[model samples]
Target: MTDEPQRAGRRTRLYALTDGRTAAPHTVLTMDTTITAAVDAHDGLPSEWRAVLAMCPAPNGRAVAEIAARMRMRLTPMALLLGELADRGLIHHRPPLEGAETTNVHLLMRIRDNLARI
Candidate 1:
């Protein structure tokens, strides 16, 4: 009942945000890809875009999955928004390191151990 309207509205908003595009032009982005705000001034940009930029500060960036979770947005659409921003030079993206799964296993193990301590 009430859920119907909310879902419809969310669909409408997502369509508007991505301009009805189901896929991003550049498909290199992955869940672990890092995103950073390239420009400090986002004046005149849409609220959604501004929000995404606000989440990603320079230097230490946020992972694609983290941003999507934080914004309550689906990964595909978030990737679309990020692709548009990157096209406009408003943001920068770095794909995950090659062989991250194999290379970062040690790091992941350490983090897991630390979490178990808490």
Candidate 2:
């Protein structure tokens, strides 16, 4: 997201902490790893990213591009993060509409190009 691999690495670590655990059955902590991770992710989220996610998975569960502008976030990184969230199953990714994927890519590229100028 920041033109560096380390941010992505850190994001992966953050996702591991915040996702994939259920409190059902109320079992004891099998590992302290999860707790630590959650704390880490919660503390590390970029203010912008955190703010974006706070308003995400929109009321209608719209596509990433649709939400990006509203959040004033760059499209490429937001797309990457959406993929990450979906991969983690923290959020659901609806299969694109018949041609939504194509249109989505076009929009993202356009946004990326436009932002590059600034």
For candidate 2, list the clashing residue pairs, or say none: none
Candidate 2 lDDT over residue span 1-118, tens digit each:
4311122322333335335332222222111111101121244655434443554433434445544555444665455545544444444444444555457877769756855643
Per-candidate TM equals 0.69, 0.37
Best by TM-score: 1
Candidate 1 local lDDT, residue 54 = 78
Candidates in order have lDDT scores of 0.72, 0.41
- Candidate 2 regions off by >4 Å? 1-59, 99-118
* Candidate 1 per-residue C-alpha lDDT over 1-118 given as tens digits, one digit per residue, 9 for 90 to 100: 1101112233336667667766666646888888999987466877767777776888977778777776777898788888777877889999776775647878778646743543
Residue 10 alpha-carbon offset, candidate 2, angstroms: 17
